[model samples]
Target: MKAFLLVGFGGLAGSMCRYATSLLFTRAQSDFAWGTWIANVLGCLLIGLIYGLSEKFQWLTPEWRLFLTTGFCGGYTTFSAFAFENLKLLESGNYWTFSIYSVTSFAIGLLAVAAGVFLTKM
Candidate 1:
């Protein structure tokens, strides 16, 4: 029960943050779903940091890990939105945008995670 509450609260906070990001990006008037991309990539980076810290310093308890990774990061990242956006781009004949967005998101997301982990080593 305690763990559940922690995860629930973390998810709530993460979801709120993600929504705020979307609102901020919406103001930019760009067709790209920058908010979702940023959120997912940032979430990946954050999870990497959290895991690295956990491994290096034993800082986070299991409960904290669950809250941060499974709850917060899970809520913060938007895989469904990413997939849907890609579908929209494909359907709309924006192959160039779709290809770039899809490739960059994956590549950069992996790099962000690696960077976060590397930062912890230093």
Candidate 2:
């Protein structure tokens, strides 16, 4: 229950932050998805930094980890979590699994989006 609350509240906050940050990059005339691109990159960097810090520092707790990574980063951009997991897989020399994950994630994500768009247009 406590973990759920922590994640929920943290996710809310993280989502708000994502919205605000993305708004900063939004341009009415621009066709590029800069806002999403920037958000994903920033989220990945932040997740990596937080994870590294938690690994190096003994003071960071499990609750904090849940709030920051699973909750905040998860809400901000799931791409960051995917990136983090892929990095871990690569670091551990699980090249086959990493390759599968990377390829499938991209392919499935694009397919899913296209499907959604097609459905919406219908």
Candidate 3:
């Protein structure tokens, strides 16, 4: 519960920050997907830091993991989360699940992007 709120609040903050950062960059950069990539990378680094710190300091609880890992990281990234989960599964020798998840995620992500682009043209 506590973790949930922390993650929720962090997500809200992260999302707002993502938008603001994009707006700022769009004014100056104007290259490609600066926003999405930035958010995803930042979220990934943050999650990694959180996990590393938790492991090092033993400061993470179930609630904290829920809040930081599931909540904040989730709000920031669905793609990275999928990759991380699949990687962990495969690393732990769950090859079948990893294979299924990897294929599904890649297929869905590609199809969804295609569909979104097609729809946007309409």
TM, every model: 0.60, 0.94, 0.72
Q: Candidate 3 lDDT, tens digit per residue, 1-122?
A: 56667878867766676677567555454668877777777777877788779989999887777677777777777655776687679779999988888898789989999999999999
**Per-candidate local distance difference test:** 0.81, 0.92, 0.76
User: How far off is residue 110 in model 3, in Å?
Assistant: 2.5
**Per-residue lDDT of 41-89 in model 1, one digit per residue for the tens?**
7777777787778989999999998898777877787563466468679
**Best-fitting candidate, scored by TM-score:** 2
Model 2 TM-score, all chains together? 0.94
TM-score-superior candidate, 1 or 3: 3
> Candidates 1 and 2: which is better by lDDT?
2
The residue pairs in collision within model 1 are none
Best-performing candidate as measured by lDDT: 2
- The C-alpha stretches of model 3 lying farther than 4 A from their native spots are 1-7, 27-31, 116-122
Report clash pairs, candidate 2. none
Which portions of model 2 miss their true places by more than 4 Å?
none
Candidate 3 worst ten-residue window by lDDT: 21-30
